[model samples]
Target: MRTLEALATGTPLVASDYGLEGLSVDSPGTPLGAMRANDVDEYVYAVGRLFQDEKLQEKLSNNGRALIENEYAWEQMTQRYEQVLLDTCSKYLVESQE
Candidate 1:
């Protein structure tokens, strides 16, 4: 939830792999919204890189915000959940009729 909040607020992130678990931020062939850093040294390097690179910061900020707006927003999540429920109900109805 904190990660979603940060993304919603357009904050650039340097997060651990564990921190990003279960999120869609690591899709293949796509830029990540946050830099993944597992250890102290990796965290330090990622933070330093984030601080020093303006373009990277902008990219991360935009990607993160877009991710939240597209996938994690209340409206979006509600729609997805509603669709899942509808699909499940439809499947159950069809199976019962069989």
Candidate 2:
């Protein structure tokens, strides 16, 4: 949730891969400039890199914000949830009638 907030606010991110499983932020073909930190050392290194590289920080910040705006905005996420709830309720209603 905090990550979403950060992304929404255009903050550059360095997060754990496990925390970003479905988003594919650090995976192959990831569109965002986010870096993944697997451990403490990597986390430190990633933070240092961001601090040292202004261009990289800017790229990551922009990409993170764009990604959220495109795919994970509150309105989009809520619509998806509403669809899931409606679908599940419809399915159960049909099954119960049988």
Assess each prediction's global lDDT (C-alpha) against the native: 0.87, 0.85
For 1-98, candidate 2 gives per-residue lDDT tens digits of 87778777988989887766567566567775588898999999999999999998999988888889879877998999999999999999999999
Stretches of candidate 2 above 4 Å error? none
lDDT of 1 by residue, 46-95 (tens): 99998899999999999999988888888988999999999999999999
Give the worst 10-residue stretch by lDDT in candidate 2.
19-28
Worst 10 residues of 1 by lDDT: 23-32
Residue 88, model 2: lDDT of: 100
TM-score of each: 0.84, 0.84
